[model samples]
Target: MAMAFNSDSELFPMVNVNNAKLSIEEERRENVDEENRRKDLPINECMGEKDANLDAIIARYAETINKYNLRNLGYPTNQDFNYDKLAPLFHFHLNNAGDPFVGSSFSLNSSPFEVSVLDWFANLWNIDNSEYWGYVTTGGSEGNLHGILVGREQFPDGILYTSQESHYSIFKIARMYRMHCVKVGSLFSGEIDCVQLEASLLSHKDKPAIINLNIGTTMKGGIDDLDLVIQTLKKCGFTRDRFYIHCDGALFGIMLPFIKQALKVSFKKPIGSVTISGHKFLGCPSPCGVVITRLKYMSAISRDVGIIASRDATITGSRCGHAPIFLWYALKKRGLIGLENEVHECIMKAHYLLNLLRDAGIGAMLNEFSNIVVFERPLDDDFNRSWNLACSGNIAHVVVLQHVSVEMLDTFVHEFIEKRSIWSKDEQFKPLCIANDVGSKNCACLMHTTYHITFSFLSTFVTYPTTHSCSPPPAATSITVLRRLQPQILPPPPSSPSKDSDLTTVVLMPTLRSTTVVATVAVVAAILTLSLLGIYYLCLTLL
Candidate 1:
């Protein structure tokens, strides 16, 4: 005879307990042993002659890199590109020595290609071709260096101001130039705190302001409000001439133009310069970027170079001519429509990852119009290293670039969930509190969980039944339920909690009783029915 269940709870249980424990420490040890296998490989000692051994070493390195690329998820680098056709150009050393606009005596330069790439960006950024002057940089850091240099040249005594969340390169540049830098605070969403910025500006009213705005922050993918920032500057009594805003777009510089309703990084606004990384979103074979500033700004720093037969306006003397071609090819091949589709796809994948994490009861957050999904940092170092997860403080982020696919994300989430189970098996091992990092609403810490439940219960005023109570379970039980949800891993406890645990004791324990519980169930059922009817009627009226 088949088993028959009268209730849904009997048919489909909420938690299927798993008592087995996985040996993750052994697995971590195995990984360390494997990593040490190549420790005794060839060093920087010069080889006497070209031999088969050298070729073998190169081949082995390539194979290793190919394997590693599969798990390269931490950084915001797009690995989905094929530049095989451009490989033939590597035969000659190509260098753009000086200003691309001015004719260089060195006929080997790819200045035409570089100019075409700059013109495309200028148009995209709403700057007239004649009004803008820029060059292909080695990377985003070089771009920032050049953009900030332009601002510094304009205002020699100007104080540099950037949010604390801005790229580390910004502060480094300030140090290199020996400029006074004011690091403003950022909001919970990782965006620049305008209030703090306003205060900083007011305090430094004596000195002219040279602001470095992040189009997309490194860790959080937070877009500092350009309009609001500009408004703040004006409100602080800074005139257009008194301030110079340099936008370090980097990963999002090439992407933002393609996104509709996104704040435009344009010269039409009061921005002095804009820089974007070619390798980040475009997936160039090598690290490269573009920096565009007003043509008038060039006059302050540029000098005629007779050796190169061109003006010396750029940061570096010998620029990679091939970088421009790689950038140009990417832009032309994708066009606007292809790039736009890719941006949307990346954002969608980010949302997919966020939903998957939240559904698994992991604390996660995704900022609006961003492809970076922030979540609680994994406790296992081996797990973090295996997936190449970028972590800061209590939070970790996965930058969903064009190369990241849904299948890859699914695998990543699966592994993360599995590893998390192992990390939380001990009754004492509690999930880290990421409330300060991602805000309480998104955080799944015990303290925040209580707040969330209380808010929800208050919103619908219908009391929960003793049997079917809505209160959060005990720490051990909640961990068990989560493990049941992801049954593939029956793992062990983590090392230790990084911070203090806020594991609260549960109050409303479930009861298998009848008297008052039955009456409470009836009221709760009626309330849910009425709430559904109200939503149905609201939808009908809107239609």
Candidate 2:
């Protein structure tokens, strides 16, 4: 039977699943090649016939995997794949060596499938087939390696800039390349702090910039504002030719495109490259990713490899051919409509979990356009391991992936609330303060509880320039409350009072009795309020 690697063929498979495995008698009937016979001579002399031990070990491993998959709540991987129909592909040894755009010399390679997958991602990111060049990488880390390398090639003296919240891979790539790297601050929302970024850019104005923009951060799922970053670059005197932006959209890159209001990451923008993990939202069985960059950028890295008869531009040679097939199969099965529904469902379920936590008085937060529900870390390590929750410091997050159901969330929350009651009873185990992680409004700690009350009382009498509720800046180094409150003392108008004059600082004695006494009390309250906030903020800063 012949298999055609095309969109239609991938959509409707012709291969029979049961007939995929060949019997020993059938295998013996085929003519043996000289290389095969040579390889088999040594193996035949060393070993006997296959036994049931290997089968039993695999079965036990599968059982354990199935059990763990059910409780996989913390990771971004989608564990709902059925790729049994594609089992026939396992018979052939496949390797997609060199670039996907250039045909490989190896006949057994799955380059056609790899090209199809690359074309699909190219179209999604609004790059024409002729305009873009990419290859299916091992995972997101390789994608970063390639993208950053391209940026470095473009500007040899460029300084790498990425948020502190970005994946550990970005920093590692910088160190590997031996490029000067700058760690930018992030807001409480986990997005890159443009204010701090502007300061950094101005200081390093002599060198060109190579930025690793996070489409979605690991812990908080923060999407950096691409437009704002571009604006900041221009403001810092970095021209179009001087800067390169590589979007590391490991998880949200696929989901954000389907979202109507999401900031689209199109090639039309000034971005140099975009990369996404195939195993994340699309859910391939193994770790794989796609990185797409402009065709023009390939000139710096491309070199003809005579052996493979293709360009050696990719980060690794002999890439996983099986991974591309799996990626293509996953994408073909779930079209744009199917992907959108899954994305929305995950976000909705995240909101459901957030509500459950808040109802139970658990300090929790869910970002505006994210499926990650972050909350206080569980006291029990066994409980955390049971759910496979990813914890960072005082906070742990549940990445509401496609497999995480409403029922599962309910069960998890109920267990959490019950465990929390027991944990809270212990005097030594105080409630973890997460005001710095999630905003002051979201935090329900003893200090922030008083902090919230004081701010709420102040908001009644004082009109701030900005809203009272603001998330903490990166490192929680500054107080938003002090920055926003610019109190203007307005005296009553002589003829009549204007709306601006409503919040009066002074009035005539005849207008109200004991006006002096009232003013004195208000002044005293204001002094006490500032003193209390200062003490609390001081403690937070020291910690």
Candidate 3:
């Protein structure tokens, strides 16, 4: 009994498990109510309030954007171009034709819209072929894809030759078609190594190949010597049948035709096919690319891919109708003279920028044939010098703003020079040196220049701001230099009005005194006239 004295402990206390469970349930409900209260707080205050707040945010964003002078720095995805002005002429109707698509599958069998556009394009190229055929794609890349697909069909077992600097999409298309891509070396200037290309093609003489000639390379705005490439092809015994030449003139095709004519250079070599993007220099919205081919080659490619059908040559089905319409509208709006003027203006602006950079002692490069100008920092300069300076420690943190005014370019260069001076003394600082490095290191700046201009098509909508500011004040030496030199570079502000007592009295007091005197005289004359007239009326009534 003594040993079992554990009975002194009140045995087992009654456990209320249900109450604990009920308490947890109540806590959960309270938590849920708290959450609901938080959710309902904004809603209970107002119903349309969210939309109003969103609208306010959007308005502020738009205003801030307007504050920065972004004329042509950013590319635009869409544009109105006062389309509404010509809306009366535009017609929309249901298709009455039995087939969904009204246009012919083959571009040679032209529709009213296509025929007109093609004729205009052909005229720009100064080609005699009224029978030239081309179809509009999303952009140059898509155009290249279509061209490559056609090329593959035309030569089933042929290798494709393009510079190592050729656009990535070309390689992708070649791989997709299971074709061999022979990459030729690129020169420092960004042009393809014609000698190396010739050697590669000669080595592959036993196998059929297609040479992808780039009118303009993406990296340094380098243009291949078309004449040289054509000569090389001939020397290598490459013919139109055994090997085809596809020109990926995505960036320059639209402009080159006009440029050629202006320079009086002949583009008569009868290249097998050419691809161009309307969105690049021609300035359209979205992916509007044209694949131009001789009628015979077009016919051959059309028949080669019988299973896919020539109608389905494009990668996508149900192509956007707006592309053709917008392209046609743009071409019509920017006629031969207008296009020529734009090209001329762009070239002039580009040259101006190059000169500005050179004057500023910035090392920049320009192509003789095109408007693309790329510049980098000199190796000896202590400043941040290159495009990828931020990440690679090799170059300066410099950004190129495109479609810039002379004033804007001046300001950008000034600001960039000032920013670079801060890091000049720092042994660790290096500028991103190469164009590709700039692209990889600073996406924002890269976007402003290349991607926006070439691929994104946003360059039309935005412009570079007048003044670009940077954080962190420039180094003391640079600041001192800027302060000493700033007066010469920047325009002076307007002077304020003088507050001298004598001047105020002589100028403002006389004007006020004269105004008061004139008002008093006019009032007195009005009162006298009214009184005399009233008295005369009274006398007439008495008579």
lDDT of candidate 1 over 60-178, digit per residue (tens): 67787776688878898899999998999999899999999996999998999999999999999999998999999999999999999999999999999999999999989999999
**What TM-score against the true fold does each predicted structure earn?**
0.78, 0.79, 0.59
Q: Output the lDDT of residue 61, model 1.
A: 70
Candidate 3 residue 524 C-alpha distance from true site, Å = 99
Question: In candidate 3, what residue range of length 10 has the lowest lDDT sum?
Answer: 93-102
CA RMSD (A), model 1? 19.7
- Root-mean-square deviation of each candidate, in angstroms? 19.7, 13.7, 27.5
Where does candidate 2 have its weakest 10-residue lDDT segment?
A: 475-484
Report how far residue 277 has shifted in candidate 1, in Å: 0.5
Q: Please report the TM-score between candidate 1 and the true structure.
A: 0.78
RMSD of 2: 13.7
* Pairs of colliding residues, candidate 2: none
TM-score winner between 2 and 3, please give it. Answer: 2
* Candidate 1, residue 521: lDDT: 47
